[model samples]
Target: MESHVVKIVDIQQVTHDVKSFRLEKPAGYTFVPGQATEVAINKEGWQNERRPFTFTSLNHEPTLQFTIKRYADHDGVTNQIHQLVAGDELILHDVWGAIEYKGPGYFIAGGAGITPFIAILRQLHRDNQLAGNTLFFSNKTAADVIYEKELSNMLGKNAHYILSREQKAGYENGIINADYLRSQATDFSKHFYVCGPDKMIADINAALEKLGASADNVVFEK
Candidate 1:
């Protein structure tokens, strides 16, 4: 696999734990929205510790961006990433993902899972094709929601936020189960994009299937 070393140009905190890192885009490097590449910090002893991260920047953008959530509880790559700043370098491997956009439909994401849809939704917004899509984003609390303002501006009333831990006005409360999905979306025939933790993905997939959605219509990382 080919790898390119890119320098971090800037870093912006998107949430309490999520940070967006903008890196130098390599020459001739290209990727479709929703695809991700394996990334490793260009540091001794950590150069081989590659982790998959989705691209949050558009292809036309001069720099590549990754919105990552740090798990400080564990001594992991993301924790290391949170400590990086401008002038740091990272190695990016080949881009690959299966969460491509098929059509305007419901996008169900949990916490950091929203990273993959960031680029895809941004592209759709830029092209003025974001009208038919609806995003059902669930987080533990309002503070945990990433790009909340941007997503709301992009999708308007289509941006739905559900808080699983906190109950607040203007946000739905509870987990996104089969009943929740059924209440929010009536059409199970439309395409569904889901991403999150392994268990969340599995549960959502089963819920979608139980709601009469065909397995072929659901798009997710396999």
Candidate 2:
């Protein structure tokens, strides 16, 4: 496998705990919207500690972007990654086959899982193919929603926000179960894109199947 050492170009604080890092795109290092590559910081004591991160940037863009959520408790890779600056360097490996866009449908994401869908939705919006897509983003609180403004701008009223722990004025409450899906989803045959923790993915996929979505029509990190 080959590797590329790239320099960070910019960093933006997306949410309270999430960050967007823009990095130099190595020549010929193209990746699909939902693909990811193993990444490691180039600083001492961290060169070989690689973790997979989804590319949130479009394939045709000159720079690469990664939206990452920091885990202060873990004190591991993400914590160290959050401390990186614009002049820092990172090592990236070849891209891996991850989630892919398969036409318009409902996109369901939990917490940091929204990273992959960001690229897909952006690409679709740029191509003028975002009309039929719906986004259902679930989080613990209002502050945990990443790219809230951007998603709402791109999706308009199709963007749904659900809070499992907090009940806000306009956001929906309760978990996304079969009953909730059956009530909200108008078309059962549409493709379902689900991403998040393994348990959440399994539960949502099962619920989608129960609500008449076919297993083959479900797109995930499998």
Candidate 3:
């Protein structure tokens, strides 16, 4: 509801179409993982559009951070965020979101949808609460996988990457389906969190029901 003026302190391209921005919060910034805030940039004093992006960093410090992936040939909010440089002042709205990590179990993420899970995984790993969690990340190509090195290092066998349009050994090359999900589950009682394109989320939700994962066991962004 409320907004504050903040500065973009850092930006790093995570992939060909993805980047991460680190912001210096104005005085007292606060937000939880999975929450999001609106940011607006202006070159002419106050003439910029605002965009909402999920907070990929845990709320533990004053500095705020977010990971964003750009759409091809698009010059909208995502592109604007990519163009930001150090010392750029922007307006940051207060964080708000009801979807969050309620512990972990089975995480199904598609492409850039892995952003929230990245932050959640880090927090869980730090707290030793990720032992029972399994992540199945789907992307168009290997190059599109964000946080690959970190996920591999932290997840060990609990993590898997699925490339839908590329062939690779060990990694499945196709849309993730009920069969594939069932193969990875050692327990049917695990909770499920599905985040991605609308179609992917819909498919995953159906698959969960087919596996007897009740409505209460599956979580999705409304």
Candidate 4:
């Protein structure tokens, strides 16, 4: 599909390695909360490579935003994303995704995998659609959490954080495994949005199965 150039409006570091890029949305560009677009860096030897990034902002407006976590040692597209700066230009393709909200439920995320859930949560909050929802976010450490303050303020009492490296009073000190999911989630009937590395997602799925959640209720991002 054809894409157009979007100018970077702002950039801010959300964590040690994760950054959020806000862009001035081009005319006619639109996207949904859980949708993702391919970002193409137009540098030499970078044309044919397009990387998928989820929309971080809730609204489809004049500006677009993406929160990205870069892996330094990995020789891949994410490394290129880390090197981007404001005033730079990147090509954005139309949005697409399969793992989206059918209705509010529970969100299980790990590492940099919370991007889509953030967008969905924001939209639900904005429209007063988030009456009953829970978020279980797992990261290596406190510093690894993205949008910590914002998520805390927005989700408030309904959200929980799990840090594998640091033991905090209110946070769990381990990976979000099947046992964690079984204990934290109140209703297995509720839809589950699981995102992250393969192991985390698979573990959650396995837990959900033990909790009597149907496979159809669990959605995975492609």
Candidate 5:
């Protein structure tokens, strides 16, 4: 597969553990909003340790961007990513992902799973088509919600925050299960986009199916 070596032009901390990396976009590179590319830091010993990261920048943007969450407990690619700064280089492989926007519907995401929807929602907002879509984002705590202010501004009342660990005012508490889905969603027939841990996705898919949503209408990363 073809790979592009790009330099990190900028870096911004989106949350306590998540950082946004802006990299130089290669000429002729293009990708759908929800697509992701395998990325590896351009350094010895770790150059082959590639990980999939969604493109958070719009296709028309001059540069590429990735919003990554660092898992400090593990000696993994993301943990290494947190140690990088501007001027660092990375190798980006071919773009591929199963998650894509189907239509106006509810977006259910857990923690870093929100990365894939970042570009999709940004593109929709740029085109003024973000009215019918709602986002249900779940995190351990309010501080863990990446781009909370931006998502709220783009989705307005359609943005719902669910905290599974720390419960605070203005945020829903507990896991997003069949009960929560039924109570907050009025239309079970609409499309449902889900992304998160594999188990969470499986559970949500089952819940969606039990709630009268067809398998064909549910979109997720495979």
Candidate 6:
């Protein structure tokens, strides 16, 4: 497999636990919105610890960006990634992903799963096709919501924030299930894009299926 060692140009804290890494794009390297690649930190003893991360930056952008959340619970790749800074190097593999924008639909994401939709929504907003799309982002708390300001500005009232563990004044307090989906969505026939933990995805997909949505119309990472 082809791999490129790219240098990190910049790093910014996106949320309390999430960080955005802007890496120097390799010439001729390109990927569609919502696509992802295997990434490994170019450090001793960690060079082969590759993990899949979605590109949050648009394909046309000069820099490739990855919006990653650091999981400090275990001594793992994400924990290692949080220690890196600008000028650090990373090994990136070929781009491949199952999630792609098919059309305007409901975008359901959980926590860091919002990474894939970042590029897709940005591309849509850039192309003036953000209408008819709605985003349902569910996180543990307000501090866990990544790109809140940017998402609000870009999506306007179409964005819905749900806090599973904290009930903020402006956000909804609950999980995204059949009840929630049925309450907010009027058209079950429309496409539904979902990305999250495996259980959440399975539950949401099953709920959508039971809510009169066609199985083929639901898009997700498969």
lDDT for position 219 in model 4: 88
Q: lDDT tens string, model 2, 1-222?
A: 999999999999999999999999999999988899999999889999999999999999999999999999987899999999998999999999789988879999998999989999999999999989999998999999999999999999999999999989989998777888888899978889999988999999989877779888899987
* Number of clashing residue pairs, candidate 1: 0
Residue-level lDDT of model 6, residues 1-222, one tens digit each, is 999999999999888889999999999999999999999999999999999999999988899999999999998999998899899999999999759888888999999889999999999999999999999999999999999999999999999999999988999999999999999997887889999999999999999988999998899999
Ranked by lDDT, the better of candidates 1 and 4 is 1
**Model 4, residue 119: C-alpha shift (Å):** 1.1
Q: What TM-scores do the predictions have?
A: 0.99, 0.98, 0.92, 0.95, 0.99, 0.98
Global CA lDDT computed for model 6: 0.94
lDDT of each: 0.95, 0.92, 0.81, 0.84, 0.95, 0.94
| Model 1 C-alpha lDDT per residue in residues 38-116, reported as the tens digit of each score | 9999999899999999999999999999999999999899999999989999999998975999998899999999999
Q: lDDT score of model 4?
A: 0.84
Candidate number with the higher lDDT (3 or 6): 6
Model 4 misplaced regions, further than 4 Å: none
Error of 1 at 91 (Å): 0.6
Residue 184 in candidate 1, Cα distance off native in Å? 0.8
Off by over 4 Å in 1: none
Give residue 86's error in model 5 in angstroms. 0.8
